[model samples]
Target: MKAVAGRMKRWRNSLRLRLLAGTLVWIVVAVLAAGWGLSSLFNKHVSRQFDAELGTHLDQLAANLVFDEAQTLRLRAPLSDPRLARPLSGLYWQVDRMGAAGEPETVALLRSRSLWDAVLAVPPDALADGEMHVHHVRGPNDEPLRMIEQVLRPAEYPDQALRLIVAATEDLISEPVARFNDLLGFALGALSLGLIGAVVVQVRTAWMPLERLREGLAQVHDGRNAAIEGRFPSEIQPLVDEFNGVLARNAEIVVRARTQAGNLAHAIKTPLAVLANAANRDDSALARVVVEQVALAQLQVDHHLARARAAAAVQIPGQRTAIRPVMEALVRVMERVHVERGVQITVGDFPETTAFRGETQDLQEMLGNLLDNAYKWASSRVDVKVAARNGDLVVTVEDDGRGLDASVREIVLERGVRTDEQRPGSGLGLAIVRDLALLYGGDIALDASPRGGLRASLRLPRA
Candidate 1:
C-alpha cells in the first residue's frame, strides 16, 4: 500500500502525466462532439431521402387519378410500388372529396388496396388547393407513419376538388438511422483508440530530452562529470546551459574561499611565530603573559580556520573520499606513534566502497581525532569500523581501555573539556571533531564501548 501511494504521489507530481491526462480529456470531448454532430447530419440526410420517396409516390398517385361519369374518383393505373399493392404492407394512399357548404364531414372516395378495409385518416385542416402538406399520423394498422397529402381539382372536373395522401411506416426511416448510428459508433471508437495511441507516442517523444537531462544531472551528482553535457533539443538547451553556468559559478566561489582561507592561515601563523620567539628570549612576567596569550591566540586561529575550510569544502559538489585508505593510513601512523605501548590497531569490517561525501581532508581530520583519542586510552587494542547507513557514513572507533563515566560522556564534547587532567595535550580533539562534523551536516557521539573502553561514533554524509 505504501508503494502504491508513493507511485500515485509521483504520478500526481509528474509533468508528463498531467499533460497526457489533460490531452486525453480533450480528445474524449472532441470525439463525443464529432460523433454527435456526424450522427445528426446523417439522420437529417436519411430523413430527407425517405420523405422524397414518399413525395414521389404521392405525385404518381395524383397523376393516375381519373373521375367516372358519376364524378367518383379512382386510380386509372395502380402505384408501381409493390408494397402499396399488399394489404398491411406499411404503405397506403387515400382519396377524399371536399364536403359541400355547411357540411362538416369529408367523404372518403378511394384508397390503395394495401389499406385492406381500413383507411388513412389525416387530421382535418383548411388546406389550399394544389398545395402539399406533410404529417406524422396513424395508418391502417394503427402503426406510426410519415404522411404526405395534397388537395387538387382535376382538369376533367374543374370545380370538384379532391384530397390525396400517401404514407409509409416510420420504421423505414428509424431503422436506417439506428443502423447508421451503430456503425458510426464503431468507427469512432477505433478512431479514438488510434488517437490515444498517437498521444502516448507524442508525449514520450516530447519528454525524451528531459529524461536525458535528468541522466546528465545524475552523472554530475555521482562525481562522474563536472557539469551537464550532451546535445539537447532546441527548447531544452537553454535550461541546460543555465544549469552548467550555475555549477561553474559555485566552483569558482569554492576555489576563492579556499584560497582566502589559506592566505589568512599563512598571514596569522607568521605573526604568532615571531611573538613566540620574542617571548622565549625574555624572562619577565610580562613576556610570559604575552607568550601564553599568543599560544591561545594561535589555537583559536587554528580552530576557526579548520572550521572555515570544512564549511567551504561542504559546499563544493561531488566530493567523494574512500574511507578504507584513510582509516588504514591513520592506523599505521597511530601505531608507530604509540610503538612503545604496543597498541594493536585493528580495522573492523570496513568496505572499500564505503565513502564520505565531503573532502578527503575533512574526513581525515574528523576520523583522525576520534582514532587518536581511542589510541591514547587503549590498553592493547584499538578497533575502527566504517559503514554506510541511510545516506550517511558511520565510523565507529572503539578502544580496550578504561572508559569515561556515563555522566561525563556528553561533557567531553565541549571545547577544552578533558576527561583526565593528567593526560598530556590540549582537550580540543573531540570538540574539533564535533565542530567539523556539524559543519559538514554530520555529528559525533561518545559512548561506552563493549570492549570496556570509549566508543566514538562519527556520522557524515555518504557518497
Candidate 2:
C-alpha cells in the first residue's frame, strides 16, 4: 500500500497533470460563458425582429379595414398574398375594439386560426397609448406565442380607438433561435473539449523531459550514476545545467581534497617517523609508549587520506569500465604479495559477457583490497569468482586458511574497527572496500567458505 501511494503521488505531482488540468478548467469556464452570452443575445435580437415584422403586418391590416361604400368595417387583402399560404406561417394579426370607453374588448378581425379561439394575452406591465412591448403569451391553439400591439386610428373616426395586434407564434420566432442555440451549444462544447485536449497534449509533451530529469536525479542520489544528460524545455534547462555544474564542482572539490590530504600525509609522515625513531631509542621506556601512541595517530591519518584519495577519482557521463581487467591486475599483484607464503590463488572463469560496472581504477582498488586480505590469511589455495546475475555482479573470494569466527567477521567490515590484538595492519583495508562498495550502491559481507575457510562476497549493481 505504501508503494502504491508513492506511485500515485509521483503521477499527481507531475507538471503535466497540473498544467493540463488548469488549462481545461480555464477553457471550459471561458468558452461556456461566451456561448451562454451569445445564446441570450440571439434570443433578444430575434424577439425584437419578430415583433417589428408583426407590427408591419398589423399596419397593413388596419389600412385595409375600410368601409366599402357601406360604413361597415371590412378587411382588404389580396387574394394572391404570399404570406397567407405559408405552412406554419410566421405572420399573424388581430384587431380588437371597444364599443365605448371602459367597455370590454371585442375582436374585430384575425388573419389566422393559429390563435384558435383564445385571445393574445400581453404582459400586465405593458404600457398603453402608442407603446410597443414584447410579450410571451398563450395563443388559440394553446401553443406558446410572441406578439406585439399597436393602436390603430382611422382618419375618419379619430376620436374612436382601435387596437391593432400583430403576432407570430413564439414557436415560429423561437424555432430558429432554438436551432441556433443548439448549434452554438454543440460548437462551444466541441471547442472546449478540443482546447482541453490541446492543453493535455502541450503539457504532456512539455513535461516529459522534466520527468526524465527527475528520474536521473533519483539515480544520482541513490549513488547509481555520476551524471545525467538530455535536452530540456526552455523553462527548466537552467536547472539541468545548474545540476550538472554542481556535479562538476563537487568532483573537482573531491579531487582537491584528495590532493591536499595526500600532501598533508606526505609532509607529516617523515617528521612523525623521525620523532618515533628518537622516542624508540634504547632505555627510553616512557618515550617508547609515546612513540606507539604517535604511530597509532599516524595510522589514522593514513587511512583517512586513503579514503579521500579513493573518493577523489571521478567519472564523467557515458563512460563505463569493466571489472575483469582490474581483477586480473589485482590477482597479479596479490600473487606477488603472497608468493613467499606458498599460497595458491585460483581465479574463476568470467566470460566477457559477465562484467561489473565501475571505473577500472576504482574496481581495482576494491577488489585488490579484498583479495589482499584473503591471500594474507589463507594457508593454501584461495578461490575467486566474478560473475553477473540478475543485473548484479557477484564477486566471491574464499581461503583455506583459518576461517573467521562469526564475532570477528562482524567487526571486520565496520568503519574504524580493528582486531583486538592489532593484526599486521590497522584493519582498515576491508573498511575501505566497504566504503567503496557503498559509494557504488553495493555491499560486501563475510561468511563461511565452501572449503571450510572464510568467504568474502561483494554484490554490486550493473550500470
Candidate 3:
C-alpha cells in the first residue's frame, strides 16, 4: 500500500506524466467521437439510398399497373429489376385492394415472385394518394426489410382504392454500413496512433529546456558552478536570470556581512586594548579588576564575531571545501602551537574527494577547535578520522588521555563552560564548533574514545 501511494505521489509530481495522460484522454475521446459520427453519417446515407431505390421500383410498378376487362387488377409489364422475378431474393413488390375500413385486404393481393410462399406484413398507416410512406417490416423467410408504400385510385373506378408497396431486406443498408465501419475503424485506429506519437514528440521537445534547467541547477548546487549555465528558450530564460540574480545577491550579502563583522571587531577591540593598557600601568585593585573584565569582554566579542561570520557564510551558495587539505593545514598549525608538549597528531586515511558543503574558513574554525581540544587533553597522541555516511561527513577527533565524565560531556559544549580552570582558555572552543555545525545543518557530540580520552564527533554536509 505504501509502495502504491509512493508511485501515485511521484506520478502526481511529474509534469511529463500529467501532459501525456491529459493528451491521451483527449485523443481517445476524439477518436471515439469521430468513429461514432462517421459511422452514423454512413448509415444515414446508405439508408437514404436504399429507400430511394425502393421508391423507383414502386414508380415502375405503378406505371405498369392495369385492369383486365373482368375488372381484375394485374401488372401489364413485369418490373425491370431481375430480383423482383427471383424467388425469395430479398426484394419484392405487392399490390393490395383496400377494404371499406381503409385496411389492406390480402385476399386480392398481387406480389412479385420474390414473395414466394410468404407475404410482406407492412403495419397499417394512413397514406395519402401518390404520397409514399416507409416502414421497417418482416418479409419472406422472416428477413428484416425496409418498405415503402403508396395509395392509388383510378379515375374510371374512383370507388376502388389500392395500396402499392416495395421492400428489400435490411441487409441492403446494414451490409455496406458494416464494411464501411470496418474500414473506418482501421483508418481511425492508425490515425489515433499517429496522433499519440506526435503528442509524445511535442511533449519531449517542449520539456527539454526544463530538464536542462534542472541539470544546471544541480551543477550549481554541487558547487561545480557558481550559477546556472545554459541557453534556454525564451519561456524559461527569465526564470534562469532571476535565479542567478538571487545567487549574486546572496554572495554580496555574505561578503558585506563578513566585512562589517571584521570592522566591528576592530572597532570594539581597539577601545578594550586601550583600557587594558591604561589599567596595567596602575597596580591598584580597581585596575586589576578592570583588566580582568576587559579580557572577558574581548573573548565575548571574538565569539560573537565568529558566529556572525559563520551565519552569513552559511547562506552563500556554491561553497564546497575539501576536507583533507583543511585538516592537514589545521594539524600543522596545531603541531606548531603545541610543539613543547611533544604531542603528535595523526590523521586517518581518507579520500581526497571527501569534502564539506560549506565555506573553507567555517570548516577550518570547526576542525581547528576540535583538534586543539583533543591535543590539550591527550597524553601523547591525537587521532583524526573522517568518513562519509548517509550524506553526512563525520569527523572524529580522539585523544589518548583521561576522558571526561558523561555529565560534563554535554556541559562543556555550552558557551564559557570549562572543565579545568588551569586549561588557560575561554572555554568557548566546543561551544563555537557546535554553533558553527548547527548553522550548517549539522551537529557535534562528545563520546568516550577508544583511545581512553574524549571523542569529539562532528557531522556536516558532505559535498
Quick one: best lDDT, which candidate? 3
Error of 1 at 182 (Å): 3.6
Once model 1 is optimally superposed onto the true structure by TM-score, how far is the C-alpha of residue 229 displaced, in angstroms? Answer: 1.9
lDDT of 1 by residue, 76-134 (tens): 89889999889899988888887754122455788888999997778877788888888
Task: Summarize candidate 2's per-residue lDDT along 27-112 as a digit string, tens digits.
Answer: 98899789889988998898777666676766667667775666666677632336544544554556666345523265555444
Q: All candidates' TM-scores? A: 0.77, 0.66, 0.80
Model 2: weakest 10-residue lDDT segment is 310-319
Count clashing residue pairs per candidate. Answer: 0, 1, 0
Q: Lowest lDDT 10-mer window, candidate 3?
A: 100-109
Which stretch of 10 consecutive residues in model 1 shows the poorest summed lDDT? 99-108
Report the lDDT tens digits of candidate 3 across residue range 330-361: 98899899999999888889999999988898
List where candidate 2 sits over 4 angstroms from the true fold: 1-24, 67-71, 78-81, 85-90, 99-127, 151-161, 182-254, 271-299, 314-320, 328-359, 368-413, 416-425, 437-463
Angstrom error at residue 393, model 3 = 3.9
Error of 1 at 142 (Å): 6.7
Instruction: List candidate 3 stretches off by more than 4 Å.
Output: 10-20, 270-295, 328-351, 370-414, 417-427, 443-459
